[model samples]
Target: MRRITVPIALLALLGSAVPAAAAQAAPPPSIAWTACDPAEEVPEGVLCATLEVPVDWSRPGGPTIELALAKRPATDPSRRIGSLLINPGGPGGSGVDFAYFSGSAFSPAVTDRFDIVGFDPRGQARSHVVNCDSDLIGAQYTQLYPDNRAEYADLRATNRALALSCRELSGPLVTYVDTASVARDMDAIRAGLGEKRISYYGVSYGTMIGQQYAELFPSRIRALALDSNMDHAQNIAGYQKWESLAMEGSFRQFTSWCDRTEACALHERGALAYFDELYARAEAGELNPDGQPLPPEDLVNIVFGYMYNPNSWFELADTLLYLGQGDGGQTGRGEPVPNGYLPVMCSDFHFDVGAYPVLRAIEQAQNRLAPHTRLNPLAWSDLASCQNWPWKVTNPPHRLRASAELPPILLANSRWDVATPYEWGTSLASQLPSARFLTYDGVGHGTYWRSDCARAAIDTYLVELRTPAKGTHCPAVFPSSPVSAQAVPTVVDPLPQLTGPFRR
Candidate 1:
């Protein structure tokens, strides 16, 4: 692995200007719809298209990248209101895949009234993806949690190497994958589709894009629905605190469920104590149900992934029970490879832990905030991975500047979302005075698919332009047992399919 060093002068150039393509007076060229490639696996009626957007929005005539798009035409074209753009929320999530596979997730009323459109944001799937060396990414020294100064240096070195590889393989687009750029691409999409305004459904990280778009093009939004929101106003400490707090809260909810639910495999053994024992075994390098040892970080990541949905609690309980009983049959699950989306995260938020001392302090605070979970795997990963990322912070965290003329945007989040957290939604609602917040008293990353009440509220808001009543709350729904939980089809829940650093 070769260590690549970038000059401080180049870093300054990268961060010099925030792209403002949405403010450009010139209109984008219209898209020409065509059939999707057979490999895309789109449904029968779905149409595919590509729109040309500047790799560096500030230099519109310099270089352009193609943004992939998918659209499911309205079921009833006669009553079509407009296009409803949907994004499934990884900083790397494939909106095109969401449009093809999860179109059924929306209500018939919504489907009948609007064309469901999804675009793979720049440097994401179908679009020009950020590429990096896999071996460097998977290197043992690339661990996110560094204990000492030497290990911290190795982590930073590895991150810089990965960034260099991405730049080398991906070209200039890698330096411009910020959410603000994506938001500008969205406005371009709206223009290309020839619609005066477009309705939007953005979840998790996608909410950040939607929020920025609203700030840039407030008058051009027909309706906006932000689910599992990202609070773009947090500093380093605030970001870690809220994320770790949410992860810890979800773990507690799982333990509480195990205590009362007779169907939970770990109910008799005690969920928390059993999990703690597993953690101890992992740390001791003895927790090997299959032949390979499970590292403590991997153990925590497994738990973190399961916490994304309440329906997966039973599966999580069973997995832990199997591990406790030394059942190799349930082990040996392979982790997803890195998709090189860190630049998007690195650019959108500032997570610079200047030195190991600052990093140690942040870890201490997180541990105190989330003793059982220790730290949020995703949140900590973002903070640690961006320590020495070569890309400049193009769209750093700041107060949201939503327009007063903006319509009432609908916001929804689960009370126990391990990924996005409930307070993020409320925090955003406070920032956008016209926005209405909807709370689902549940455990999950997203509210729309998990709760019918939430879905109804969102659909009504999107289709009828009527916001949910102030202080509206949706009841949580839980499956009876592990077997019954498996009955919930995977297609209905589209977010978990997204694979990357920020799986939200």
Candidate 2:
């Protein structure tokens, strides 16, 4: 199998060479720790700090940027391992806040064994942020998945204006907010911590940073656990197809549950047909939920958002029922729109603005193949933004590999994830020489924080360096059954599994 041979190939490749800078670099300046502002949503015993890293790694002593940090020291220092840095995805998500939020909830064993560390990657919130026009961003977001050639032209113009605005507001820093730069920033943090190597836990987009770090400084990793991965090897078309199919797959699973379970609020004999009607009405602009009418694209996005977790399916069912009745209220709970997502994603991947027609045709073909969940506006928006982006990416798309001398890493993902998708995690695992994959056969974007099985695997791996056997699957906690919807207690949104802690 390719998976079996990849590690062997990577080991040979890594063992043959080393990065000269990483090999001979001196420690950067020490960080100054202080009490976090009381007004900030900080967990107990969390101290704040800042590290100065180069905006451009090539010129280390040139322009500098401050990266904010948060730390929860190990409860039992005598038994403590070194610092374990954590990033909760969002190329934009604030790691500093994540330290306070997730760190506060870490199990005693983990808190006692390792210092929980988190940092806002350069150009993210709490760091030197990339500011854009709030009004323009809100207005243009989700506005450009046009229905006609004329509309497409409008989309292009809108994108051009938005792109120009972003560049004007963001300046040169926007071009440098790539994953490669973020990885270098991680190394700076590692050296500042006085650790020979550091452990890491990265979720979603955060995994990209982890992968890059492992490739650039393979010998500097103590341990790594990547959950809900985003495959950096995917080009624009591949990215669109993968995400569209994943979203559709999750939608189909939700409908299947409804077909078999009476407890689902939207349970009916022809559930898929009912959904088709909703989609048609949204497309025709004949259905308005609450006061605003949702375009077919926005409607699909709403449904896709609920696909993040099975527990939220009931809410999704209710939303569909309301739409069926020509009533509109709030849809089901959704993930917070990322502020830093566009800047970072656009900067990392290559997108061709001139290829919009061809790309849209390809997307349409993919949609036809998967009609149940078509109109993937998320992919469209990302590609469009990148096409129109005024800045160049300092770190372009690339695969990742760990040096043979680095510690083996762990990866976890739910089998039915939509946001980052399960296959992305598998893809990442295959590419890395020392990666072990853990699968959760459940519904959610992330697994480690919510699933005991996943958490146990990660904990054992971090504490004892015991990798889970390949092909291991964690059983789902909530299995589908036809029961009363009201009888089952609804759970709080699991979307916050990563984003809640670091939203400052």
What does each candidate score in C-alpha RMSD?
A: 6.4, 7.7
Best by TM-score: 1
Each prediction's Cα lDDT score?
0.83, 0.72
TM-score of 2: 0.87
Model 2 scores worst on lDDT over the 10 consecutive residues at 1-10
Name every residue pair that clashes in candidate 1: none
Clashes of each: 0, 3
Alpha-carbon deviation at 215 in model 2, angstroms:
0.4
- Over the full model, what C-alpha lDDT does candidate 1 score relative to the true structure? 0.83
Instruction: List candidate 2 stretches off by more than 4 Å.
Output: 1-27, 327-338, 479-504
In angstroms, the error of model 2 at 485 is 10
Location of the lowest summed lDDT over 10 successive residues in candidate 1 = 1-10
| Candidate 1 per-residue C-alpha lDDT over 284-328 given as tens digits, one digit per residue, 9 for 90 to 100 | 988888877888778888899888777888889988887766724
Write down the TM-score for model 1.
0.91
**Model 1 stretches astray by more than 4 angstroms:** 1-28, 140-142, 327-338, 488-491, 500-502
